[model samples]
Target: MSPVAGTVLAVLLSLVSAAGYALAAVAQARLAASAAPAGRGALRALLARGQWWWAVGLNAAGALAHVAALHYGPLTLVQPLGALTLVAALPLGAYCARRRVTRTEWRGALLTLGGLVGLVAMTGPAEPGEALSLREALIVAAATGLLIAALASGRVPRRRGDTGTRGLGHATASGIASGVGSALTQTLTAALALELPGREPVWWQTALLAVLISGFAVGGLLLSQAAYRGGLAAPLAVVNLSNPAAAAIIGVALLGETFRAGTWGWPIAAAASLVAARGVVLLTKGGAPAPEADPASSTVVVTGSRPVPPPRATELPAPLPAPLSTPLPLTVPLSVPEVEPARASIPG
Candidate 1:
């Protein structure tokens, strides 16, 4: 296939993959209302949800598509384009979860999209380099470990007063983890490449990859769920931006990939990042996302096929009339009149 054709194919697949992710996000968000904290209990709750499983399946599909896109396209192109998932998520949330997106939210989403486009346009071709080395992998792993520890220690405690803050914390944590996960995934992919030809993967290497993938995927997902509990806009934006940002950094550091700086390139990328951040703030300002309706709150009086309705209000009977202070006048005499009886009148 021609280079143009390959790129087109990659772009299409990436968009499709983004769509899948959007759908999955909506599904997971719907289930977020019921989600427990991140741990064995949360894991159990997440596993019990059919929506969670469906979301997982969708996520898997998206990942497969994403990996394929990365195989064909430059990371510069594909990584940034992944932000499209955040924009796509709004409409999917509206459709799948029936959440309404306000005008401000839409504008924010559009701004994010616009910023991503600018960022992409400003980015030039990436420089190529050698395969990932063990030293670089160890460094990445160590950094990831440190980041995870900070995140877990710093933000795991939930704040009743500022759930948003808690959520942002979770989102940041999840994003960093996901970024590391992205690197790990790329590394794993590289490992598999060796197996593609005549080389057989060593058992130890396979086990390590398996463990990393499981930890990254599961850990990132649980944290993501925690993030969503706070709301969509902030955390979602963090995730959308962080994934690519982290991956780009890792790619540059490990892969020796360099960006070709054009006249306005750096400026545009920085400005675009600002615009994306502004859009995320706008999304949070619009309104807190309404939680999925509780079935327990629904009433029989509900008329339609829509999701659960607000609890039905019942009217209380009017208070009984207070007792009269004074006694009312009686229509009849208070006592019956007594009649005199004749002594022997009835004998005859």
Candidate 2:
């Protein structure tokens, strides 16, 4: 296909991928909100929900589209486009979940997407590098596992009222695991295709990569489910940003990739990262725990069309005088006058 045609195909596929991801995120968020709290049986409960299954299917479709996009376009072009997932998710959440998208959330999502796209765009493409050796893969996997454990070990915030701090942590961990999984997937694919220089594919290494990939994929999914319980926008932003950021770091460290703008690019990336962090803070602020009702405050009773406030302390009727502790003295004189002798005398 011509370059233009291929680019167009890549863009379209990327858009489709974004849409799928956004829909899945909305579904998962709704499930997390409505389903029973996370526990030992949480996964089982999620599995029982048809919505969760639909989410999983959508995610799989998105992943496939992402891969196809990569096939048709350069990573520099395609990876930045992945940020559109967040853009798509905001409206989908508002519409699908019947949740209002606050202005803060919209601004945060945009900032995150802009920062992430900018960050990834600064990463120039590197020549294809050799796949990870078993030792390298093990090292990466171990490090990633440690990071995920640390992030996931924190106490989860309450599902009903929280600032999403714990959810953000979980989301970060999920992103890392997923990013590493993607990296491993690439390595495995290269090995399977015999793209590694001067080396025949090793069966054990391939098997190990597959195992690692599966482990990370499952781990990320579970973490993401937990993360959404706090709310959608902030945690989703964290996950989306962290996923690409982690992968880019891995690409640079292990895959011989470098920044496009060299020394100057680092500062720009840092600034973008700061902007993204600000955005996340804004999102979390937007999800501030709903104010608890004050018990001492006057209650408002809705009557007909208007709210009627309960009587103020001053307006309340005085309590009836307490009943007498002792019976009252007889109203009659204690010693009544003796009654006069009756009319017997007159009869006589």
Candidate 3:
């Protein structure tokens, strides 16, 4: 197939993967909610769900389709197309959950997809290379460092009274794993194909690829579950951005992919990334926990009228008047009055 046709195929396959991810997420949520207390069977239970099985099958099909597309096109082209899964997963999750997704979600998802498509289209295919080098190792290491930093920051935010923080935590981990996974997959694939002159992949290279694929599958499952449970915008954005960002960097630095758009392409890509990030932040903010109600300020009904009952003899304010012209101020003074000694313990 031509490169153009391969790109199209990759995009279509990504949509299939996205649908699979959404279904798997929902299934994982259901199973997680119903899992046994022992926790020994949680993984099994999650995998046991029929919906989860469907998700796995769909994802595998997507991976195979992606591989086929890559054979015809480029990694820079194909990997970015895979980000379309985020677009597909959101609406699919909403529909399956029997909920109507908000306009904000649709806009965010679409913008994310558009931004990714642009970023990928700009990148040319990977250079045919056989083996990993020290320079590539250093680059991967730097990316990994950034990933770790993000995770640390996510944790700190959660610790500081951020109740909606789990989503961020989950997203961060997912993003790092997805990004590294995609990059490594590319590296492994190129190596195993014997693309490099005078080099061939040994048993370890094949084993490594197997491990990476398994990790990607499992991580993708949990991440999708977390994303669907948390809502699409943030998790999807993180995954979409991180995976391609990692892949794009590798494509440019190691695989020698480039864009004719010049310096502007870099900034545009960064801006698009931030836009997606803002959407996630907004989604997370919207899901924050509400403040607790103050029972003291609340009104209680003692017959027809709402009133604050007087304290008992043991308590202060015995036989307090009811239904006054104006409700007695429930405000608490800084200093307590000596006369109302028993009531002094309670706030004025």
Candidate 4:
């Protein structure tokens, strides 16, 4: 087929893949909610579903289409199209789930797409390549290990003061994991040349690729579900920006991919990405109300509204002998007390 036709096919496949991912995310969210004791296991259940199979299957199909596109058209064309998933997924999720896509979400999505398109258009096509040598591989291993350690250590502990912090912490952690998974997948894909399936293909490469794909597929699915549960904008921001940013950084630093456009292009792209990310954060934070300062206090206020007296403080009370001496006369009223109006106003 002609290069143009191949490129078109690739773009279409990319959209399909995005749809798969979006569907997977929605399905995972539902499973997580329904599966008692929501956790990683819900994600597993999500992936186990027939719908998930379709999602993953479409993803694979898109990957193949992408590979074909690489053969025919410029990488510049195909890579940017991958970001189309955001545009596709949001609308699809809204339609399928009856979820509302807020104006902020739409804005963020558009900005993200525009920035990606601008960046891809400005940068030249990528030259297909393979993994680094053992030395470089070691360096990457060390870096990834350090990142993992940091991730582990960076827990937002649920302390005495605030439970709300816990949600943010979880979302951030999930976002990081999803982002890292995306970055690694990109790296793994580049290193392994995923399409080269043969009888004697390198087992390590194949194994690593499988792990990466599974990790990303599962992590992304779960994280997105969590995002919707927590609030969509924050997680979406992290996944969308981090995936491309990580890939771009690695592509430039490791793969030696060069930006052919004037020096302004890269910086402009970066700036736009930052803006889009900030917009997402703002939108999410705006939607989620701040937690009450003291949960206990709020509880007290709720219970206090009843005519019942507040619970006795868990402290020793004065002896009963002293309480018996405090007999007081009670006065009874013949009628309910009347409330006096401050001022009289004419009816409208």
Candidate 5:
């Protein structure tokens, strides 16, 4: 395809992918209401649910579509386009849950939209960088491993009284993993491009790249859901913000792509990113937990990513009182003579 056609195709594919992601997020949120605790048992229960399955399928489709888009267009261009998911999620949430979109959500969405516009406009043409080297991949792996360890350490936040603080931490940590996963997509695209000729060595390399990308993507998915269950707006913003940035960096570093950031480009991009981050914060603030929210179970009710509480015990009602004894007939048989009036009548 020509450059114009390729770019258009990439844009269209990215949009469809965004829609899929929105639907998946909605499905996951509903399943969360009945989702088991986060563990082997919960995973099993999650898999058993149709909504959960739908989410997996939709996200997988989105990922595949995303990779295809990257294969054709610049990562910087395509990555930022993924931000469409946030905007799409708003209406999807309303339709699926039959709830109204809050003003805070709209404000956040608007901010995200504006930030995306600025980010995309500021992005310059990308140069095709060299494919990811083995050393670089290893470095990425080590860094991500450490990040996961720190996030999972269960260290309490300094302000224990403030609810959602720890959850935000979890969201941030998981968002980083998502960013790495986005980078992996760019790497995969490069590897796939090298494999078109079908040489034996290239085939092996491509296979390796595929495995790596799959691993990271799955890991990202797990972390992302965890982040969602842990916190919504914070994690949502974190993922949306970091994922593209990470991909852009990878495109420049590993894929031989150039962003051509000039004297003003860096500042513009930075400002736009900050705007997007602020918008995400607003989205979360607007969707604050209810006053009577159970720190754990309430997560299942509204916060999409936060951990879902196990199915509440089915409440059985109390038994009803026994029926009153049956009443006797008004008329009595002569031989039965139930009343004392018979004795008085014989004496008279």
Candidate 6:
């Protein structure tokens, strides 16, 4: 295929992938909203739902498309396009969840996407590098696990109105897990592709890598499911931005990749990151306004334009002493001589 044709194919596949992911996110968000709260039984409940399975299927399709896109085009070109997932998710989520996309949310989504795309564009193409050794992989995996636990542990109790914060934490963890999974996948692929004479690929090492990959992937998926329960746009934006950023960091640290613009790129990347963070903050702020208490159920009621506090227990009048069951007899008796005295005086 010509370069142009391959590039076109890659772009198209990336778009398809983005659309699939966006749809899946919406489906998951809907399911999470209705699903039981996160616990030991939550995963089982999610699995029982047909909609959740549909979301999984969609995600699988997206992953396959993403791999195909990578096959057709360079990472530099394809990775930036993946940011379109957030772009697609915003409207799709709004439509699917029956929520309005606010101006702040739109701005947040755009900022996140722009910053992420800028970050990816600044990254230079990766050169061939040594596959991560088992020891290195284990270390990375252990560290990632710790980070995930920290993020997902909910060590600090959340308020009823803090679902957005909870979701953001979970989404961030999900992104890290996913990014690590991708890095491991790349390592495994590189290891398999190595053509060293007289040395067979170690079976145990390959098995370990596969296991690690699966673990991270499953972990990421569950965290993402938890994330969507809060709301859609903010969590989705966070996940999309964090995923590539995490992967890029790993790529630079372990995969021998570097920034395209060298020394100057750091500041630009930092600025972009700040912009993206600001966007995420805006999106989070826009999360379904902490659900208003039902007026009917509230102690305060609105009369015309003013809120009236319910009558307090102290404000109620004391009940009159219970009515007497029967009338009481008179206690004092009258004297009988008064009439006789009057009569005697008249006769005299």
Which candidate should be chosen as best, given lDDT against the real structure?
Answer: 2
Q: Where does candidate 6 stray beyond 4 Å?
A: 155-158, 195-201, 290-310, 318-348
Residues 1-348, model 3: lDDT tens digits = 676776677666655655555555445444433434434765676666776677567656666776666666556666666766666666665676577666666666666676667666666655556334434643574566566456635432424335434565566666666666766665666666765334565787567565755665566556555543444545656666666666667668766667647777777767766666665665454434456665556666688776865444565543344534334454345235654787777886
Candidate 2 per-residue C-alpha lDDT over 121-189 given as tens digits, one digit per residue, 9 for 90 to 100: 887654665566656778999999999999989987555456556588899999999999988887788
For candidate 1, lDDT tens digit of each residue in 24-45? 8777777885636665676777
Stretches of model 5 off by over 4 angstroms after superposition: 1-10, 68-78, 120-126, 152-170, 173-175, 185-208, 230-234, 251-261, 293-348
User: lDDT (CA) for every model shown?
Assistant: 0.69, 0.83, 0.59, 0.55, 0.66, 0.82
Per-residue accuracy of model 4 over 1-348 as CA lDDT, tens digit each: 876687777677666655555555555444433544455676566656776566456545655655665566566766677667667766665666576776766776777677656655655533544444434434654565456445435444444433222334334445455545544555556556543322334678556655755665565444445445544444444556555555556567866666776687778777766666555555454334445575334433454475433444553364546756654532234222322232333332
Model 3 worst lDDT window (10 residues): 152-161
Q: CA lDDT of 319 in candidate 1?
A: 28
Better of 2 and 3 by TM-score: 2
lDDT of 2: 0.83
Question: Which digits, one per residue and each the tens of the lDDT, describe model 5 over residues 238-259?
Answer: 6666665665566556565544
Candidate 3, position 225, lDDT: 55
TM-scores for all predictions: 0.70, 0.83, 0.67, 0.62, 0.68, 0.83
**Could you tell me which residue pairs clash in candidate 4?**
none
Model 6: residue 2 alpha-carbon error in angstroms: 1.5
Candidate 2 TM-score versus the reference: 0.83
